[model samples]
Target: MDSIPNQQHAWVNLRRGEPAEALEYRADWPVSKNLEPGEALVKVHAAALNPAGYKLMKFLPNFVANRPLGDQVFGWVRSDHMRLTNQGALCQYAKVREDWIAYAPSNIPLDEVAGFAIVGITAHDMTVKNADLQAGQRIFVNGGSTSVGAIAIQIAKSRGVHVTASASAKNEAFVRRQGADEFVDYTTVSLPEFLWQRAEEGRKFDYIFEMAGVTDPSMYTQSDSYLSPMGFYATVGPQPKGLYLSEIWNLMKTTLFWHLPRVLGGPKAPFKLVCLDYQREDLEQLQRYISEGAVKPIVDSTYNFKDTLQAYERLMNGKIAGKVIVKVNIEDN
Candidate 1:
């Protein structure tokens, strides 16, 4: 390993906007070395992009954002999601709390494992914790091709749950490869109507995992028809791209429906927004799955650290089937 430097290169967010507009690459950025008692400094080899990274960049300003400098990436350090710290993974050095760290699977490389923390744990949270699925039960994942959705499909399938997931027709094969038993071409029909039709045909899901950052509430509001009586609807959250009227209207409707009582016309099924909390056990479980090949890491594309903005562009374009990685330690990759 190379000697740790006082200053290192990083992608810093200047203002809230798209990645291209909000981020600047600075070589003089100081490495965060002041560690709290349990924190460890890691020399990042690679980092992976997630939709939440750009979404936060576009929605929040620098001062209040936990990851003000760049997107969170898993790297040479163990696969754990870092939070409430200035040390983001887009830089060469990141400070991660000891509780968040887990041993990387010996079978995978740094770049591939770099995308594991967020998506993997999120899938585990949705499939194992929130929904509490069981063998022979059925689940519907709204965004099968998404990083989280892909992992969720595999996790559910590994537990013997039947998975029906959605993506564009082009990604049907890709989604199915992740162990989805059924695939829905989301572009072919209105999702709510399609789900209703499925329900009418006697097909109901034990749980619905909305991994897509959908702002529209109709699919969830109308979930009573497709969701089993005791089943629940889980979502990453209602993520709006911007403050457009349509987005705002959907957000408002989502909030209203979320709080509305069933007696007052809310859906009969339960709804929950899956928020990921860092847990050592959860991280270890995911690592175990990786080691067992139950959960596989998929990298959509990779770029040098210099082209991180380009990597973000690919991520925000919304067509990727897997994680977009950036090689931070150029020589190591």
Candidate 2:
């Protein structure tokens, strides 16, 4: 049997109890814990980075917040927990639940699966559950190259829904190749006006998936003007403002100003903030999607496990075509 270490390397949040700007980067730290039922040993290979980590200190409903926190990447078969704690995936070894894991497909590289875990499940939830999209309908996705948006575009398209998306000019071809039927270069064309023009032409989308990264608030608040009469608008990943209570205040303010009005009979249209629930069923579905070639992981870059902080900084910077990952046992995988 392969030997497992009682103490392993990890990145401890030195900034614990401090404010948001207080970053955590100290590595080579120690982590020791025991395994429980439905849990087994795992040697992490690669881990993906997402903005979801910013919510480390924030609150989530228990049903949607079960995973241990990090490690939404590929590792040796072991367990199935995702709502990981702050000192999460960056560790060398983990005791994960068996149900939390889905075996890697032989056709794809182990390192690549790192980016698919969270974004894939989130996109599936948004397109399939929240929006309840149907074939032949139209949909719009902002930040087409973003981790979530990229997957969302493909998921909706696989069901025969027409997809329109906005991205930087440089990423137009990349997004188009990812299955967008119509590509809007946001740098050259104003997104709202472009959509509004289509609305004027009697073309409206049945579903709109907002993946954050859009700066104009009016685009969201005034979507009803361009949305179909009975359409759904859903979002995930709140863009954090300041490091302190600013993040909390932003959520409250959005709920009060945007979501509440849309739900209770204001002018903003039917809207919601969507989240992902980890399930073995979803992972099995993801495996099927991969086997069918309807979706594939898009990796923007990779960093050594020692450079985990640099990887996080790159993800936090918010400029990339796809997912950024940290390679733990990179030399092998």
Candidate 3:
């Protein structure tokens, strides 16, 4: 183990706004070295950016109305439940819950491994936990080129499930490369209409996983046309583009879809928001998948320590096909 430093660099959000406006890079942020039982300090080699992190940064001003707060480049410290109170992975070192950590697959590059946990865990929950899909079942993955979608496709395929997924035509090949059995070019057609056509052809899917955080409810509302009677629909959650009335309207409709009872003519399939719950076994399963090449970590781009802001900008642009990684310990790059 390397000698721990007293102070480390971190990207702090002093106020709420876009990444560039809200974040300030500090070289002398204090390092919290206090370790409770089951906590371990990680000398972070790299950290991956998730849209949730920034979305929270933009929306949540403070946890206690004024209390300020603050990955892995991989050793463990404390559970993710402590995340809000502890320092974030955007710094040089992170303390994570011991049970939440797992060994990185030796076959994966260190930079890519930094991103595996979050997406991997979410994919596991979506495909394995929530759906419990069996061999020969069929699944539809929205945003097939996105990180979670890609991993979900691979995980589904590993279970012998057929995967039909959607992406823009430009990412069709990328989506297919992640083991999708069939592809839908969402940009070229109305997604609901296309699925309805498949339904007409008796190609109903047993599971539908939404990774794009779509605000539109039409797909869920009309899912009876294509989803199996016993099928399930899960999502990361709806993400409104902005606070505009249009966005608000979309959310209201989505909320209704979620809460509406089947007796009220809601979609036939059940719905759920697939959130990642940390489990040591799930992390170990992901490590095994990576070790066996059943799943591959997809890194869309890498940014150096000083260029952390640029990394956030790339992530916020929302055009990338995989996880956006920041190399926290520059020497690791």
Best candidate, TM-score: 3
- Give lDDT tens digits, candidate 1, residues 100-198: 656667777757887877788889999998877789998999999989999999999889998889999999999989999988899988988887888
Better of 1 and 2 by lDDT: 1
Task: Give the TM-score (vs. native) of candidate 2.
Answer: 0.81
lDDT of 2 at 223: 79
- For residues 1-333, what per-residue lDDT tens digits would candidate 3 score against the true structure? 236778988777788777888888898987778778986666667777877667876311100000012122242222234346446777766665666666667786778777777788889998888888899998899999999999999999989999999999999999999999999998789998988888889888898899988898888888888999889889999888889898889889989988899899777678888876767888788889989989998989998978978988898898999988888774654
Model 3 ranges with Cα > 4 A deviation: 58-86
lDDT values for all models: 0.78, 0.68, 0.78
In candidate 3, where is summed lDDT lowest over 10 consecutive residues?
A: 59-68
lDDT of 2 by residue, 181-240 (tens): 998988888777888898998888887788864433556666787899888667875666
Enumerate clash totals for all models, in the order shown.
0, 13, 7
Clashing pairs in 1: none
TM-score of 3: 0.90
Q: Is candidate 2 or candidate 3 better by lDDT?
A: 3
TM-score of 1: 0.88
- Candidate 3 at 255: error in angstroms? 1.5
